[model samples]
Target chain A: MLSNLLVQLINGIALGSTYALIALGYTMVYGIILLINFAHGEIFMAGAFVGLMLVTVFKVHIIFAFLGAMLFCMIMGVIIEKIAYKPLRRSTRLAALISAIGVSIFLSNLANLVFGAKPTTFPPTEEILFKIQTYELIAGAQITNLQILTIVTSAVLMVCLQYFIKKSRIGKAMRATSQDYDTAALMGVNVNRIISYTFAIGSSLAAAGGVLVGIYFGVVKYNMGFMVGLKAFTAAVLGGIGSIPGAMFGGLLLGIGEMLAVALGLSSYRDAIAFGILILVLLIKPTGLFGTQIQKKV
Target chain B: MLVVENVDVNYGAIRALVDVSLEVHEGEIVALIGANGAGKSTTLRSISGLVKPNKGRILFEGSELQKCPPHKVVEMGISQVPEGRRVFPLMTVLENLEMGAFTRKDRANIKDDIDKVFAKFPRLEERKKQPAGTLSGGEQQMLAIGRALMSKPKIMLMDEPSMGLAPMLVQEIFNIVKEINQSGTTILLVEQNARMALAVANRGYVLETGQVVISGAAADLAKNEAVQKAYLGV
Candidate 1:
């Protein structure tokens, strides 16, 4: 039973890596503009679809398809920011929120229109890193290379992001604009350009998450982003909006919590388990685990 | 040099400034002093492109700035340390200073300017790694001014630098303002603290209800009976 728990923990890390990737995108977008891009999930779904099309129809290599998917998603993120959010900036927050929802619905239906309502499969390839080996002491428990790759990739990406934000000029500009847009603009930082770049980076992360999940699950669908996106968003809130490392921690925690709940015979209540963690965390720390509580001036 | 010719500003139906005209020459400190809500800040905002004027032209070094954006205003050698010391709260003092040189291409000179700001405000140097938000109000004000100075702007637009500082800090800040001016950068100051403002100023303009009610040399405006009774509390 102890070995089983260890195997489950390893599996949870892989699942958590995908969640962390998606969550970073969500957190970055939310951090800078405070606008939740509802279509972000659909954008991830579109990325997978883009990758699927490249591999099947165009006979592109998996590696090239992944790059194309990221580029496509980044461009889409920029357009959404420019068209949907930028013009309505002067409007009420509610208007932007509603428009975001509109973008989500529009993208989901557009995917249905373009790709059709069917699950698309990637070309058969030996993409699995290694076979899962079960241990006797951990009876009925197993681990695989896929899991290790996911965790390692997630960790590397997160560390790279942290370094970029801390040590780079554009990254510093992003943090400043996120803190206060007006002040940043007055300081000669181009606020709009920074926001667009933020969306591009966030979307690219979501694309990476999409391609990995597609490789793991073996089947890509039009609606994959709905549940995963929701979960990733929950991760962003759990860690704290605007914190780079917080999203990774939140994602991994949420993934493990879900996996453990299922492993312990509560499989039916997995959604409840995920939400329960969110509510409990909010109760303990209203601002989130890593979020700094801002004192609003009257 | 800066010139504002018959500028007008409005928010919805409320007129914030009416035919406001002002000028600041090279190597001079011009003070725009008034009570609360006199639109002194608005005038500065207009000149800095933070707020657009409804009528009239703003010319900076012979270029019209009707459609210029805020950062472009800074690139034109005009930097405004806005009211309330809007420092990047989460950023370190050094990072905030670096933001001041965002538009510049001289990476080496930018580093030197940062050192210059630290040299000017040694308190900031001690707290260089600390977040700007954690600093005292006076320190944050000094950081704000220092950040503006990082841009190497020819004309500095400052609004209410002494608004919330204690009397001692206020005096110290005024002295720093005089020092900054003496070092060759022109200043366009907007302040509600009229006495200290007029004292450091080369010339003064008293704004009332968005209109320039009185304009004179600093010493002349300080002794104006109306100015003394209302602003100086004489």
Candidate 2:
């Protein structure tokens, strides 16, 4: 029983890492602009497809493919922000939010036209990323190389992001922008550039999460980002929509809770469980766990 | 050196400033004194590139400023200590100071400049690691001024620095304003408290309901019977 619990915890962590990566995108964008950025999941889906193309059509190294996907999503995120969100910045919040929803539908449909609606499989984990090896923990519990890779990569990326925000000049400017937009510009920050950088960084992180999901599941679909995006968004909301560490913690907790449901033979209700928890959290705490003093949309 | 010629600003349907014009030459403290709705802030906002004027132009050191964004305005050696001391509340005091120097490229001199700011307001250094939001109102005001100074601005635009301060703190801010002006940075001040403003300013512009109703040397404006009756509470 103890071993079973250990296995579930490890599996939960690996799954949670991907959710955390995507949640970071949602949280960061919301932090700065107070936009939900619904199209973010489509960016994740696009990242998966880009990774698939880089690895298979171009026959590149998995590492290069991963990096390429992230870069592509970064550019795409910035372009989407420019074309969709920027013009509506002066409009009411509802207008921008509707735009975000519109962008999400447009991107997902475009992906559907290009990549087909059916799910496509990755070539093979062994042929690309690494040899899949399972290590026995104690008894009846196991850990896999893929799990380790997912958790470690996400951890590293998050740490680098934290360090950059804490240390770099642009990062400080980003924080200032998040706190007060007009004031930041008054302080000589090119706010538009900061907004672009924000979209780029958030989208890149979501892209990385998408690639990891593709590798772990060995499948990618045009609409895969739809459900996963909602789940990651739920994680963001659960952790306080605009807080960084809150997203991480919320994702892990959700993943663990889902795995716990599966362990208890309630696998079919996994999605429902995630939403139920969200409802419960919100009922108790209107602001997610790490909601700042007050982040009212201006 | 700056000049504004026949500028008009409107917010949607309501006009904020109409045919407003003013000027500030090198090495002088200029004050704009007005009542609550007299468009004092709109004038400063126009100069800082926060609002666009419908008619006329603003020139800073011979260059047009109407089309420049706020950041570009800062780059042009003009920084504003905005009303209410809108410091980045969540950021540490040191970070707020660093952000003030965001447009500067001389990374090496930033530290020395920060130390200079500390010399002027030593309390900030002791609380450098603490967030600006945690500071008292007066400390936050000092941080805002220090942060603006970090840009090495040739002209500092201050709006109502004494709006919500105690009597003693208000005097202290005014004295600091004089000291900053004496140290060679030109100033364009907006104040509802006309008494203190005229006392501190070299030249003054009296804005009444969005137009320059009176303009002259500070001493002359202070001595005007109408000015004393309306603004100075004589």
Candidate 3:
């Protein structure tokens, strides 16, 4: 029983890591522009399809496929930002949000038209990469190599992101832009370029998450991004909307909580469980777990 | 050297500045003194490219700045320490100072400039790692000035540097302003504290509503009866 629970925990963490990756994009774009890119989920879906295409059509290795998907989605994200979000920036918040939803709908429908509405099986990871390998922990709990890879990759990516934001010149400019846009421009940071870079980075991270999800679940669908994107957004809000660490923490917590609900014989209520936790967290701490209360000056 | 010639600025339907002109020559501390809502800050904003003038031109070393964006203005060597010490509240003091030099390619010299800022405001050095928002008001103001200095600008536009400070801190800030001017950067300072501003300024402009009602040498302006009656509050 203990080992079974441990296995579930490992699965939960792997799932959570992917959510965290997607959530980072949401949090970052929201942080810098104060616009919720609702179409982000579609970007994730687009990434999975791109990865599938690279693998099936291009006959590339798994690593190359993953990278190809990321690069393609990065450009796609930038294009979407420039086309859909950029022109509406000075307009009302509702206008940008509606634009995001419109793009989301448009992208999903485009993917559906291209890939068909049915779920397509991904090229099996075990066949493409290495043989299926599971390590047995104490008490016979098993952890798969894929799970390990997912968690480690997520950690590394997040760490790199943190380092870039804290130490690099462009990253510092991002933080400044996030804190105050006008002040950043006044300091000679090109605000528009920073916004584009932000969208590119966020979208690429979401794409990476998409590719990983395809490998883990062994399938891809046109609309898979909708539910997962919402969950990841919930994770972002759960941790604190604009805080990077908060998104990571929120994603892990949501993933574990959902898995644990299933472990508790509530598998039927899995979807309900995720939203329930979001509602509860919002009710208790509206600013979120890691969100700071910003004091406005006169 | 900087020049604003016959500039007019409007906000929606409201005219903020009307036919205003001023000049700051190289190596001089020129003060623009006026009451609240007298377009002092508006003029600075116009100069910094935060707001565009409806008419006329702004020249920095014979180059037009009317349509230049804010970042390009900074790249052209004009830096403004905006009102309320608008530092990046979440960033560390060191980061805030680093942002000031954002336009420069002298990566190696940035550290030296940072050290120079530290020497100017030792309190900032002591709290270098702390967030700018966590600093006391005076320290935040000091950090604002220090951050602007990081650009190594040719002319610094300071908007209400003495605003909201205690009298002693205000005096301290004005002293630092003088020292900064002595070190070779020209200054265009806007202030409500007319006495202190006039004391430090080589020349002064008295703005009423949106127009420059009085302009002369600082000493002469300070001695003017009408200037004393209105802005100087004698």
The window of 10 residues in a row where model 1 chain B has the poorest summed lDDT is: B65-74
Candidate 2 on A1-298: residue-level lDDT in tens? 6777778888988998899999999999998999999999999999999999999999999999999999999999999999999999989989999999999999999989998989999989999977999998777789999998999999999999989888999999999999998889999999999999999999999999999999999999989989999999999999999889999988898888888877777889989998999999999997988876653221
Per-residue C-alpha lDDT of model 3 across residues A1-298, encoded as one tens digit per residue: 6776788788899999999999999999999999999999999999999998989888998899999999999999999999999999889999999999999999999988999999999887766777669999888778989999999999999999999999999999999999888789889999999999999999999999999999899899999999999999999999999999999999999998888887788989988999899999999999999987655443
**Residue pairs clashing, model 3:** none
- Misplaced by over 4 Å in model 1 are A125-141, A295-298
TM-score of each: 0.96, 0.98, 0.97
Per-prediction DockQ: 0.66, 0.64, 0.77
By TM-score, the better pick of 2 and 3 is 2
Displacement of residue B219 (Cα, Å) in model 2 is 1.3
* For model 2 chain B, the run of ten residues with the poorest summed lDDT: B41-50
Tens digits of per-residue lDDT for model 3, B65-182 = 9999999999999999988889999999999999999999989999988998998899999999999999998999999999999999999999998889999999999999999999
Measured by DockQ, the strongest candidate is 3
Choose the strongest candidate by TM-score: 2
| Candidate 2 CAPRI-style tier | medium
Higher-scoring candidate on TM-score, 1 or 2: 2
User: Candidate 1 lDDT, tens digit per residue, A1-298?
Assistant: 6665666676677888888888998889888888887888988888888887887888788878988998999999999999999998888888998999999888888888887788877655464234543333355556665666667777877888889888899999999888877778888888889999999988888887888788778788878888999999999999987777889999999999888887787889988999899999999998789999643211
Better of 1 and 2 by DockQ: 1
